[model samples]
Each structure stands twice: as structure tokens, then as C-alpha cells.
Target chain A: MYQYSNFDHEFVAQRVAQFRAQVARRLDGSLSEEEFKPLRLMNGLYLQLHAYMLRVAIPYGTLNGRQMDQLATIAERWDKDYGHFTTRQNIQFNWPKLEDVPDILQALADVEMHAIQTSGNTIRNVTADHFAGAAADEIADPRPIAELIRQWSTDHPEFQFLPRKFKIAVTGSPHDRAVTQAHDIGLRMTLQDGLRGFEVIVGGGLGRTPMIGKTLSPFVPLEDILPYLEAVVSTYNLLGRRDNKYKARIKITTHEHGIDDIKHRVETKFVKIKPLFTGEDMHILKEIERHFEPPNFKPAKPPVEAISTTSQPPAFRAWLDTNITPHKVPGYAIVSVSLKKPGATPGDASAAQMRALADIARDFGHDELRISNEQNVILPHVHRADLPQVYHALRQADLATANIGLISDIIACPGMDYCALATARSIPVAQQIATRFHALKLEHDIGPLKLKISGCVNACGHHHVGHIGILGLEKAGVESYQITLGGDAGEEAEIGTHAGPGFGADQIVPAIERLILGYLHLRANETESFLEAYRRLGLAPFKALLYPQEKKAA
Target chain B: MSVTPISKVVTANDLRSGEVIYLRFPHSWTPELSKASVITDDDLAQAGLAFAKGQANVVVGAYLSDVVAEIDGPKASHFRDTFRSTGPSNYRHGKQEI
Candidate 1:
């Protein structure tokens, strides 16, 4: 919900003009690929496996109707008929031509958006809690801070060339939805002596070197955030290994140096640099906070028409049970639009579907939408009265899938179909798994289960943190998968444990079914969720299913 | 087979001082560039000036640089270094079309 200031607008426009000239030079043969590559990357364009991929940033997962519409238009006109929304809250176009990327960027700039820092070794799109401003448990909205970080980090002169990509996440509530523990830098807003500050956690990352971040600073005040973050990144930028790409993430540095040493160094740097944050910086933060103020709401109970129906409409009732959450405001409910419809690709929306969502947001919900880390779209404030109309609209657009946070609601990356780095197909595998779960009608029975699939080791799907994690890797000529269990993506976040030997891509669905049945068998009672049961019993039970012959012999 | 060896290399951060050397197909050779055996410091500077004047012509593609010869021959370190660093330069998010 943060609107671009005139400075922000001018910055993006100037960047667009610079890129436009660059693109013209490349096409005119005044510059070759070697010279053009870095310039294009700085603008968020990549020539991937099949075509150019334009990664447009959705800063902190926030977008208004107009922005979403611009994305839809870009998708429809330039690439395929749809765009894939990524887990990082960015959208990727798989087939744009390199020549047209500047025009696409200009289109995005018109909406005050760009692909800056969406890729590369620098700080990525800063993600925050999807329910940041609206959640009942929030002590303060994290977006204003997130926006400030965005401004300071954008086109940062010194930190542009890092050892590896860095991700930062912030959470406003104790019940963390942003998965702060699995980021390079995780800032959880906290209060000390009635003054709001942050608990800075560092070094957490996923990939080959998966780690849960360590708390570097127990409490860092608001004014000191930028300098503090700069110190942390500067330490890593200088110290992190550049010899091997795989070992270059800040997590590796944090792990090798030990958190205490890194903390001590960051503290030293923070002390020396703290004076740079003037009162003017704090004043601007206060001004940015005004943009994020929660919309006005009138107290009204659940609508009589919806409640008066003798029996709950099974579809609407099921949707409400899974997709709606308690809002901080009395009369409003947070509505999550599940992109994980059975048999459809996860995190994909057709242009028409996007338009419908925009309409729903403008009419029934507040003119705001959030893309969740779970790869779902959220209408943050929808009144109870407009629920039916909103539901009907979503249903028409294929957005009203009641599988949010359920078994079929899988977060998957665009595997071989789009991503050049992918070793196997992710979207189709996700589709097959969703179809299998629907066939068994076991998604509802399995309850809230987070399943994540990534095509390769990049872990873009966040397979590292799913309760049921599937990692697609190439073995010989065929696609194969490795499964990990007991992963959870919430306040109590934990990286998953590998169940055992890998399964063939063809065998993955049946393997998932086996895991689900295993969960059912091991449950203490039906009331326990999949994650709860998995946690209570550990991976032993799930591992048993994966290696049944060994279990039988034992 | 007339296989011309060309590898993509980035100029260092300094534009005035650095120059990228790529192979030129005979047709791609502007009459001025066809004469240089190893690009001189002056040639690199002149190329940069030509680019500024919109008179330079360079082609972008997956060129077949003589990989086996480059790796196995005497200038192996030069080839290896060029190949290793032939990626996005200091730009973080997207590539620069310099």
C-alpha cells in the first residue's frame, strides 16, 4: 500500500531512460552481449533457457489494482497469456524478447514498479508479513520500515556486487508468517521499555547450505536499522567467499565465522556508522507510516443472509473455514485467494483472472492485495457482507479454491518449463500431485499441510521449509525427487529432514500418498494437523513409510 | 572450416580505460577493425569513441569460440580467465547493455 513519492517516481523514470538507451545500443550493435549483460541484469532482465525472463519486483508483496492490471497487460502483450507469481512475491515472464524488455520496463515504470534487485547478488525484494498492517497481534506495521529499507537498498552504490543473492524479511507479529528464520537477514519487530525496535536475526538461508538464522541483535532501535543492516551486509560482502558460487551466500559466512564473531563485528561497525542516521531519516519514516494506516471500518456482524441459510453452502463454508482469517478490525476478514487450485499450476494467473481479482478488490475488499510467501493472493480486508459477492466473482475467475494452507496448496517453482536453471519439471509435478490429492478427497482430511516443490537446489519454491518438501533433481537422464519431512513455515520454523532415498518423478505422487497415509496412521487423533503430528512423532514415522521394506524387515 | 575464435569478455569498471575483445566474422569486420591482429590500447579507445558516435557495429550471439584450442593451447590461461568472467558484470539485478 506504499505509494511512490516524487523522488521514487523520478528515480524509476531515470532508470527506465538509462535502460532504454542501453537497449537501443545493444540492438544497434554498438554494444555486444558481453557489454550489455551487466546493464540488463541491473534492470532485472535475464536470458534464461528458452527466452528472456523479466522479473518484476512486487516490493514486500504489496500491489494495488492498477499495478496488478499493468502486470496482466505486460503478460498478455509481451509473453504468454499469463504470468507466474513467485514465492519471493515477484512475477516472472518466461518468454519476452530481449529487444522488448526496455518497453516492458517502461510499462512497469508507469505503475511505479520495476525489476530492480529482483535478481543478482544484491539485496532482493524485501518481503514482510502478508498480514502486516491488518493482523490482530501486530504491535506495529512492518511495511513502512520495509519501504525504508527498499529505498536505502535500491541502487545502493557500494553493495550492488555481493558474493551471492541476499534476502531480508520482516515480521510485525510474534506469529511469524514471513518465514523470517530462513532469510539472510530477518528483522522481527519487538518492543523494549514501550519503545518499538527490532530483533535482528542473520545468516539464515536455504539451498545446499540450509541454516536457521541466529539472533545477532536482541533489540535494534528504528533509527539505527539502515546503518545496522549496512554493517551486517558489509561484513558479509567483504568476508563471504567468492571462490565458489555455491558457498558464497551470507549463510556460509555466518556459519564459518560463527554468529558471535559476526555479531561482534557488526556491532563494532554499527557503533561507528550510527551517527549517519539523522533525525530527518526518522521524520521521513514517520511520513511513510502515514501511507500504511489501516483503512476505516464499521463494526458489523456476519451477514444474516450468509448465516441464515439453514445449512452453510458447502463450497462457501469450506472456503471460509480454510481461506478466511480473523482481522484486526471487528467487521472485516482477511480473505486468502488460493492460487493452488487442483490440477492448475501453482502461483499462475491468467490475465482475465487477474482482472477479476482487481475487480473483487476494488468492489468488496479494500483496494489492496498481497501476494503471500505461500504463493497465494490475499485480499487483506473484506467485509463479511460482501463475502458472497466476492466469493461468486472469485469462483467465476477460478480463484475461489478453498485450499489455502491445505495439502493441495503447494508452492512450486517454474521448473524446466520456464526456468533455465531447472533440472526437472516443477509445475506439472505440482499439478499431478494436486490432482492426486483431489482424487482421494484427502486434502481436507490431511488438514493444513504445507507442500513445497523446487526444480533445483535454488530452493525458490522454499521446499526447504515445507512440511512435505519435494526437491526435483536430475539423475542420469530422468527427473527424480528427494523428499524431506517435518518442515514447518510459521513462527516455529524448522528446515525439513530428508525422509530417505530419492523417488523417480513418476513415483513422486504415489510417494506423497504414502506419506499422507503415514501421517493418518501416526496421528494421535484427527484434531492434530499434519505438521503437529509430524513434529510430535518426528521423521521416523514418515521415514518408515518411505522405506517400507526396511520397516517390515526390522 | 574457417573457424574464427572469439570469446566474450567484460571491460573492467573503468570505461575509458577498459575494452572488451570479441571475435569478428569477416562480414562483421568493419573495414577499420579487420586490420588489427591483437587489439591495441589505441584500437580499444577508438572503438569506445566509435560506439559513442553510434558508428560501432558489434553482434551479440552464442558465438562458437574455439573452445578446445583455447583450453589446450598456449594461451589457455587467457581463454580460461575470459570464459570464467564472461557473465553479468558488477550489475546486481539485471544485465547492463553497455
Candidate 2:
């Protein structure tokens, strides 16, 4: 975890104080709603359908036990007893009172966290792979670069009011857990000729219009990343359309002006900015790297035989199979605490659950915690020997769900339930789907499925990248769901293809059931996953299954 | 022939609490949609919205939403408003909690 410097602490505290005064002014009638709206949004406050939502950034999805404890405290004291971890790896308190947001922010700043740049048309939270430093396959920890970007982009004067909100994702592994391809800017850390650099991707986004990012530069040296990124964003700031909010993203800009032209413009800009950076950024990066140094690892053998001989519960074995990921260390494991319990709202963790997780992290997981973009918590450095203890603690908190890459592990946006922009409810549908599948006892059998639901075309759920994507929309005064197939959010990222027509809310769960069941029959073997099968076959088979009545009529 | 006017109600989020509130008769707000003043006349609805918007110190983003007048009160004509009237289906927190 990157420890906040004194300068960082002062900056965050000052911001909180500034926001508190702004809130006071607004409350006292000195600043009108029109004047205060942008200000509030800049500080990550939004008046949603039912209440104000305060989105607090967890920079690069990294935090410690103390920070997590403070988050739990804030949740219990101010907003609802729980918070929603979003796809961007930030946490959103949905029912925050407008008057209490300042206090909430102060609480956040106490733990060296702030909601600054979480919203507004500024560079949002710079997200990296949740398993960045811990994953076995990673070439390097991407957090240092992510932290560097965070430092540069936070309150960057020129980029504050860009054409649209900018998002950046970095991943250190060959496998893309950060969904780098679907961000405004994607940085994949790579080693070439014994020198570290980034494979720079520009203009990938998922919304009304989904586009896989284009490779702007195959490899830009580590030292030149900031300038290169400045070049990209600067080019986007000028070239991105402001005439239409719908087409204002860098994706549309890249689409309209071709990747080559954009690349040329960015290259031109990069040349101008390269010399201006000096080495201050590198110095800061070196200091940041020291803070992220791997924790001292103890020489311990894998607890496979010990656990196997203990007559451990079958549920523990199941959990070990699903929730645990191979860690970089010899006898360590990355335990993903599933927030999506069946019938519960996805990404929501109660204060009690949060505290439990904080404790688990402290006792077993080296005090480091991570929030995955998949809306789960990660105990990045849990020793394999302590797996049983960690599992037991998680079970106590109702966080031990043995469905990591299974069907029940769905990603859903707040949708109409909490989001003002949502046209239909997403949480209920996700809950229903997860519950239905859990009842069937078929999730593990179904195997490695990504079912994501977005309340609307905004695609907050990353529905565009799910193996099975459900997008909810309002049609004829009713909620209608549109399903897509073959979408992937991996090294080979691709936008899902629509499977024709839409289903009513009542029909969606059963429809999904038919689709998955149909897939089981259609797959080449039991080992082949849903996405692999979808790729091997096509949408035609899934379409026939999804809308069987239409197929029968035809 | 005179066309039947669609019933409407003035709605906004409370400035301080951010709870969904509907404008009542004269100059008051209520979280309950049933307690809201259902204006059948378009001009009156606009006026009510304007009035709600003018109460800037108390409310934000005031607008008119369509409603169907029943014997007891006005019911939200749209699902979105219905959600605002009640609360999110996933949780019993906002208006539903009250």
C-alpha cells in the first residue's frame, strides 16, 4: 500500500475543508443549486433519485485495515449501514445526506482518502488490477504507475473540464483483470530489452457506443509515460466533441478522426511536453515504489495435506476451489471475498462485513486490502496455511460464497434502484438471476461465466464485456432487458454481440436459464466455458435458446 | 372537443436531506406522493413546478411528473416516479423506510 506523504495529507485535508465551506455556503443560500451542482460533483457528491450519493475514491483499489475500518465507521455513522463498491474500484454511499457529505469527506480524509476526481469531467480514479502486486503472472506491480498517474491527474488544471469524463486503467499482467481495453486510456506494463515500458492504448470505452481501445504506441518507455499520457489527453481535450454529450468521449473522438491521425497529433504534443517533465516525477515514483515493497514472506509449505487430512467441511474445499487465486509468493493465496451473496445486492458490504474483512486482512492478510473492479474485496497476501482461519472468518461475516467466476457472481450497476440515469432496475434482476441459479445448484457446473447487468445504456456494469450481458431499458412503461453474448474482458477483449429482441422483467431470469442450459448441451465438452463455447459456435444457437418461442414459430 | 389533461405533480429532492419530496398545496413539501397536490391543469402544474423550483433553499431539480388520480390520491404514472415514491426494490431505506 502507498502511504500518504505529509504533502498528500495536507492536500486532502485542505480539500475537505474547502468542500465543507462550499457545502455551508450552499446551505446558507449564498450559492444556488446551479452554482453548487458542479462544485458538488467535482467533490463527488450527486443527488440521485432518492438521496445524495458520495463516491469516495480508493486510489488504484488499494487500502489498509485502518482505512477500511474508517470506511465502515463512515457507513455506519453517516449514510446507510453499507456501501456499494463500484466497477471503477471506488465505494459509493448511496443514501448520504447533502448536509453530511462534508463530514463524510472529512472522515475519508482522516484515513488519507478523498472523493476528489471520483466524479466530474476530470480524470477519474486511476484503477489497476486488484491482484497487481500479488498475482503470480504479473511482470511488475502496476500500482506505482497508477499512483504516479493519480498524483499527476488529481486537480490537474488543464484537464479538469475535458470534453467528457476520462478513465484510465493499468494492468501489470498479460491477462487483463483491470479491463484496460475498455477505458479511455489503458496502460499495460511490459518489459522490453530489460527496460520497463507501457503498451499505451487509447480511446476504449463502453456505454451507448462501445469501442476497444486502439494501440497508440506499442511501447513507451517508463520515463515517458506521463508526457505520453499528457499528449493523449491533451489531444483528446481538443479533438473530442463538445457539441454532443453522447459523442464527447475519447472513443468517439478516436472513431471520427482515425487512430493514425490521433496518434500523429499525440506524438506531436508528446514531443512538446517530454522535455518539460524533468525528473521530479521519476523521483516521486521511486519514493512511491518504496511504499509498495512486498511484505516479508515467511517460509511455509502449502497447507494442502494438513487441510485435506483435517476432515475439513466440503464447503471449505468448495470455497478454496473458487475464492482463492494463486499468489506470486510460494505459499500465499489471494482470497477474493465475494460481496455478491445470492439474493443480496451486488457490491454492497455492510459495516459489520467491512469490519470483519478489515480484521481478516489485519490478522491473516498483512493488513493490505484491495477492491476489485468486479465489486469484491481481495486479501492479497493471505498465507495458504491461514486459509482455514480466513475462510472461517469470512463465513462468519456471510462473505464466503464459492462462486468467483461462476454464474452467481454477477456484476450489476445500481440502475434505477439508486441511479438517476438508470432507465430500469438492475439490482433486482441481478439478485433474481443469482438466487435462481443458486437454487438450481448449477453455477459451478455451468463454469466460468461472466453475467453483467447494466440498468441502462451507460454500461456501468461493464455489460459490454460480460460473456452474458443483460442491459435493462424502459420500453412502453415497462422494464425490458436486452441480452448479449460472447463479450469478453480479457487479453482478447471484444464487445458482446446482441442476441436479438428483448425480454420483459418477468421473463429475463427464465430466459437466462434457457440460454445457459442450452449452452451446456451445445458445448463441445464439460471443460469448455460459456465464452469458449459461444466463440466455437456463435449467437445463432444462443439466440434460438434465448427466444425459443420465436424459434418455434419460425 | 376538449382533450383530457394529464394529471401532474411537482417533485424535487430535498436540498439538505436529498430525500425525494413532492410539493403540497400552497407552499409545503411531503415525502409521501399521496400527500402531494395533484394538479390536473397544465398551467397550474407549470406554476407549481416553478414555485417548487423557486424554493431553492429547500429543494433542488424541481420538475413535473405525470400521475394518475385515484380516489385516495395521485399514483405515479411512470415506474421511475413509482420508485421515487416508494424506494429502491433492493432495499427498504429511503421513502419506503419511513
Best by lDDT: 2
How well does candidate 1 reproduce the true complex, by DockQ?
A: 0.06
Write one digit per residue (lDDT tens) for candidate 1, span A417-529: 65657777788789989999898987788888889999888888889899889999888657789998878777778899988888897799888888888888889998898
> How many residue pairs clash in each candidate at the backbone level?
18, 0
Q: Estimate each model's TM-score.
A: 0.85, 0.99
Off by over 4 Å in 2: A301-305, A308-310, B1-3
Evaluate model 2 with DockQ and give the value.
0.92
lDDT of each: 0.78, 0.93
Task: State in Å the error of residue A338, model 2.
Answer: 0.4
Where does candidate 1 stray beyond 4 Å?
Answer: A301-310, A552-554, B1-98
